[model samples]
Target: MTPEDRFPGPEHPDSGPRHQPDLDVLPYGTYYEPEPAGYAEAAYGSETYSGYGGARYLEQHWPATGQAHNVHDQQAAHPGYEPTLPDRPSPVHQGDDPPTIELGPPLAEPVPAYPYPAPGPDEPVGPLYVVGDVHGYLEELRAELRHQGLIDADGHWAAGRSRIWFLGDFTDRGPDGIGVIDLVMQLAAEAAAAGGYCRALMGNHELLFLGAARYGDEPVQSTAGTASFLAAWRLNGGQQHDLDRLEAHHISWLSRLPAIALEDGHLLLHSDTTAYLEYGESIPDVNDAVHDLLADEGVDEWWDCFRRFTKRFAFRGDAGPQAVHELLDAYGGSRVVHGHSPIPYLTGTVHADDGAPPHIPGPYIYADDLAVAMDGGVTMEGRLLVARLPI
Candidate 1:
């Protein structure tokens, strides 16, 4: 299969062969040379995943209105490494649900929320804010938060009593991925202190990075062939700095992040895939199942979680609305608010020549408005999306 098959961006689920346009943009939906056991990844066969998959940190800012940037070439040189790691585990069937999970955080008890004055019964609830896939662009995130008045000039939580959720994929592709995670961690604590809450949903890149870190060089079964987590991570834009800076706190926080979230009537998620339906019928069941899988030490189990969640665009084409209904039926929500798939891809505005996006860069509500796409393509001449909810 061509890269188009691997990352069919915004096409019909039953799409037949069409003339492949811009092989350069082949899988614009979202690679790296694998290195030894350290920072970079090893290459699998020629099954090209989208270059936009991993971390993409650049010293320069993402082009404000330039054409969608393409990864011109793979930078890291392949280096030989010790391959004496454990033999591959048998590929487990990619299932709808991960191993069944008991509810709650991996920790013994949930962190107690500090009490604040309860709003009088009639007081209006605060605004709800949602951020799209940050992709490790920390300063861009800061600027957007500041613009939204979610943070103060000093980058502290200034939005009080409001709920802000980050549709995940905090690390990878951008500089200071760990910095973004650190900031989010700090914000969650501060937001709670200020009577607001800052939360996140796990994205595919999160699973990809975590797998690379925890089970580097350990081979897992892939539909294509034998694949290793470390190599795939590197190919997907794993930055050495982010991996190096990963701390126990980051892992603990990310692991605790729910795979599915329902906020203010929107079913918040990372990717636009129906694979979430595979986890469980309800929100809590899905979240707990995700945490349980991440907590388990099994590499194949983790691979299943990573591989499945990475699937995207389940809510597009003719069956899109029905897919949305299925999710809404199982999980209570009027809409599915998501990131992972960029808005540019949805509107076919990617890689425009003049750098001007096809549509105004904001949320692209489609699938009969049953779904909302928030990734304004900030990583690719797109704006950092800081959208208010109840649309």
Candidate 2:
């Protein structure tokens, strides 16, 4: 029979169209890449047979297809044509018939589900307060919440009928990152139960935290080229305690937090960056687009998205009002309230001491009053501000 009959398919007519080389033809003593010896079996096999010897025995018993058998030495065979490792011996069929073994007990019966009741329309909306970046200053956050009557002296939800929105950066560069997150989570639960709600926006620090948690020491491309998230986290003042306390719930929540929020003709966002214009026209659409990207993208792509979002100082100079006007025109908002750029930085204040109270100059209203900066630089010993809207 011609080689075409044996291999089959389209091949160059010259030299009988070089046949695909079979892996079995490789030398038996070919370089044996050192695996963990029994790593495969431990990963793929059951508890009963998962070690080195068991894996070796399994490979010997169920020889891979096109594997070269050494007539003299059985262990020195070349696994040429085999693309996969050997299978384990099954109890059912030991001889000619391929043995089949059940993997596990049948899945438990499906639990009955309760139908979700639809929410009523326009269910008594409350005044929304969008907070700026906290950066781990728990005491400042507490003071601000108290100032806004959102929380009481005992650090409990004080405003029984209002909503509070945190625009992210709850951790890093200051004390009590964990404490801040814990407080927010507790308040969110309490507020939801009490007919009020607490929501948050996603900031770049959150993306950094997520990357560090997932990639660990793996190198990822940043503005500084190939830098590991772990290194970046350390450089950005990520606490070891905070890293250890991070859970899937935190990551998922951070990832799902909206990039933009709209309230009473006001556009609420974390960063003062114009990169948001690349997403969509409407606030909801931009949020959805960002969420979709964070959900579907890999580490590199997500990091790039975060890097772009982290670009602040957009509403700082002469071009500031122009940028605010662009957002206002697109999203139908009269003003933009953002956080990433701290108020103290806008006012050019330097912190004297760790415990010294922050000096926030009357809310640092800028961009011709089109953009409001609320960060107050609490992380830098500045005041935690809570301003009434339409000022």
Which model scores highest in TM-score?
1
Give the C-alpha lDDT of model 2.
0.57
How much lDDT does each candidate structure score?
0.63, 0.57
RMSD of 2: 27.1
- Kindly list the per-residue Cα lDDT of model 1 for residues 1-391, writing each as its tens digit: 1111121123232211221122122121110111123211121122212223221222122111122113222223223321121222232233452222211111232223333454455645567888888877787788768656677677787766778899988876666799999899889988777667899999888898888778876768766566667666665556777777788888888888988988778989888778877778789989988888887659988887776777666666556677778788999889998888766555555444564433323566677668888876656545557777765
Worst 10 residues of 2 by lDDT: 1-10
TM of each candidate vs. truth: 0.71, 0.65
Alpha-carbon runs more than 4 Å astray in model 1: 1-124, 355-360
